[model samples]
Target: MATMPSIRRASSRTTRGSAVALALTATALSVTVFLGGRTRGPAVSLSIKSPATSTISNGARCQSRGFRARAPGVSVNLWSGFGPSLGRRGLSMTVAPKAQVVELVSRVVPAVVPEDDVAIKAFSSTPSEWKGDMIIIPVYATPKPEGAEEGPNAELTGPAKELDGVLGGIISEMIGDASFKGSKGEKVSTFVPGGSAKRVALVGAGEKDKENSDTVEALGASIAGVALDAKVASVLVVSTGSQPDSQALSSGVLGKLYADDRFRTGDNVSKPVKLKSMEIEGATSDALDAAVKHARGVTSGVRLAKDLVGAPPNYLTPSSMAGVAEKISKDLGLSLTILEQEECEKLGMGSYLGVAQGAIEPPKFIHLTYKPKGEVKSKIALIGKGLTFDSGGYNLKAGAGSMIELMKFDMGGSAAVLGAAQAIGKLKPDNVQVDFIVAACENMLSDRAMRPGDILTASNGKTIEVLNTDAEGRLTLADALIYAEKLNPDKIVDLATLTGACIISLGNEYAGMWSDNDDLAAELLESSKDGGEKLWRMPLVESYKEELKSKIADLKNVGGRAGGSITAALFLKEFVTKTPWAHIDMAGPVWDAKAGGSTGYGVRTLVEFVAKQQ
Candidate 1:
């Protein structure tokens, strides 16, 4: 039901057989072409003729000269010289329609409206034109009017709202009602549309008065999401209008497509799929080239995280996770160190080891460092709770809580940290020092599992009263945070699926962030916004710290369920000596059974924060 406008180009066709022959000979140096000629055997010479100069009349015989058939039933249509610019590759020929050179060129050229400044618009596609394989869209670029206010258009009023309503309404009608929704009060899509050939999409840079590159990137992501759902083998996105540069649009769209499929798994066969090839039309040779490369990089990073999180717990235990880190270190030139139970015992990590005691697999305290190639301005340490699987320890989860069967996502925090390290390694930012730490273990039930009411000391030698064995995330983090403090980093950030209390407070849409340092908290908030991850800063009331007080030990792991999340932060705060630290309770964002995958929530935000620090 989406509208697709017909693309138009200036008519300028020429028949130059010699030119075509020369170009073909030049191309032959780098490519091999088999052709059919007078003899039954292979032809001695092969050459292509220029496109026949004529009006694109329907069903017209468009023939080229000196084109030797590569194989039986092979046909080639030559057109005017239209090679892509340096660093930019033209759209793959596979997505082009099988027609005469004139018709094919006419159908695929850029579309422009005379004197119109709009960057995005909706067009109707006729049923006869609906090939249904893939939809090709043209995006144009328009500069925003000077003095325009910055922010999302959803925050506009009066004239802006009226204008947006018209534009949004047109887009809604083109793509169909089901393709759009309001996310956080902004118009967006729910599930990426899967049916039609490239079901409804928007091209960037329409009206000069309303142009925004950020919105253009978002539109590309939206298109990619739909492409994924449609499972089209590939997509063709064409750039149009006066915008000589449409490559940014392509990059944005490809980036989103990669992000959409990043966390997916092969086990689930029910969901809609994406196309294998994406082609961009009307892009400057340079823009098209850069967009494709950027898209591939983004997709690669996303897949890395997905693979780490999707691996089964049996294959990705604390030790196995450390092994993976060791491999990455050797491959990416990172420094890796893993502390086993013996080392942890020497450091008095009783609280962390208590959780691992129940499992046959011993815990691995992992530390990974990435130092840039210049003077280090600041050092940041990231801590992830690497609970390979959580059986709730002595406090077991049953019935609905155990339905997912795979608790491997309990190590989502660790996966995120590893993913961040991978991305940062490739990016290679300058003048920044990064340390990745993970307290990897399994919270399972066995005869030796620490029981309720037992007291254990952390790496800092601080005793903790274990009221509930299920509250084990904090037990491991307590020792991990203490260990990180010894490094004296500028900032310490820890991520964990720590408490269900966070889920109760923030729901699944946002992760609950607790930090005593305002500047660090603000920086993370900004990073979250840029990364498109939802995070809300929660209060760490001093009064809440009193709830953790224990008559027998320094503090109780569980704070009687009231302000459970805040008290958990308080318990962690006790060990962080003079360091600016933040705790991301990823309990809500780690896994979503109904959504059916790990969200990879904190990875992007954490990476963006690190990049900005440079």
Candidate 2:
């Protein structure tokens, strides 16, 4: 006996001639529509005026001055103003699903609260003029040190030399007193006696020649962690290199400075540190400023992703995940399309919905599209596994090491997709369009859950055998890949926390990547290298498909334990017909024990790839 939920919409009825038009002004976009809750409930029906033919751009209505039905979701607002007067047409239209309203509508949705805006000042001022609550100098260790009888002290050079002189040689004095040999990951912090800075620290940047974006990013992260631990509001990073990376430095600081306190209750709520501002002495160019803006956008996406992935399974169900997508579309001016269970069934998404059969939460297929006003030179599709929670279905994930409780992050792929969408939308990269899709659902245990030995058909008519219900992400992605391919995208890339074997193979620092095209893999690798996110390209051996052969159906979900990640990629490759597609097995790097929360791993790489695409 479930309680019937209430549905209330505030669109005023406007009558012209003999027809009724639903006024979908920005204020009238207040809709709290839900088809159903966790349990069964009657669907909320919506009837609007005739769909408008007007165009929608930048979240605003066009010539017709109303919403239009281009695709699904609220991309064109509520009522599309067609023929100057939708009310005069006397046409009635019925929209399914109540809550999934307003795609790319001109509405004021609450913005994602990013980490406190740490003002980054790229000043023309020299190191001598640098004054802050703390100063961090990244130093590289001596040339050779493995078997030396005594390692020589690190020399003060470049910005370190200039800043040390201004601090009355305190940095050199301390290095000598403590015998501080600058080894990688080494750190020494001390209070400044009468210097402009309250305290100073030297962070090891490894060998000078070996210094790369990863080490520099690490340096930035270390500075942020130290600044917060010391309660310093402003810090200056003295660069030793000729030109500092605005993106890498800011990303490291912002990413490391973040912490998730979502589940914290009263009294347990943790107040974040007072890190208000960071100054980089050598990043004083206009290009640097632009990079800083772009870096902030990337990290902002990362934070959004981290927050979504960090949510508990109970709090972020499939329907709720759609809600989050709708909010993102509304806030970021991205066109959105959400297909309900019925729509999915019509498209023969049995493989995707089969995984959702056991859950009370209905699967919500989400598609978010970002279109540039200029001529589209290329189109890209990004897909994510939207499993909010996975209980292993009837196969049942139970044991001492099941790690089932942590399955809330099974949706990390979807989080990364939406995170990247948020970034692409806000940054507004021109000449390229990106479509973000997620087949959001859960794999919970119930009497209705899909069982082993069940054969499910995908929309592409390809059949899948349920050999292992535990392997459900590929089932959802099977349908999503087909959907993405239909868009005729030039490139399609998907990210998923797919396998434990990936973690075993690559450890927790790098994500395994598989691609059909070598050029796409190289591009991703290059972008990842620039972003300091580790991506290891794995093999897509055609021979691996032999492992997926099923006796009754087209293929089996899981292929034994040998090369599990490779087999998983091979399975997803079946759904692709024609597209330069790449699959990322991110189970290893999705969670960083050191980052304090979800690492938001795929965001920076994906954003950089799409934003820079010609």
The candidate scoring highest on TM-score is: 2
Predict model 1's lDDT versus the native.
Answer: 0.61
Summarize candidate 1's per-residue lDDT along 1-614 as a digit string, tens digits: 42322222122322222221322211111121211111122122334332442221111122321222222112232222222222221111111111222232222211221111112222233322333455444333223347864321212223222322534443335334433222211223222244334343443333434545545556666566656656556555433323323434543554543323332369642343335555443344565555444433333344455555666665566655776776568768889998866578789899999888776565789999999989999899999888988888887867775533667777777877887877677666788899999999999885547889989988777889898888898899888888888888999999887777888999977888999899999999998876667889999989888788899999998886788888888888888989999988877776665654655667777877898889
Per-prediction TM-score to the true structure, in the order listed: 0.63, 0.80
Model 1: residues >4 Å from true position, as ranges? Answer: 1-135, 138-218, 225-235, 240-299, 399-406
Q: Report the Cα lDDT for residue 481, model 1.
A: 88
Error of 2 at 272 (Å): 3.2
Model 2, residue 310: distance off in Å is: 1.6
Question: Which residue ranges in model 2 land beyond 4 Å of their true spot?
Answer: 1-114, 240-243, 594-597
All predictions: root-mean-square deviation over Cα? 25.6, 10.5
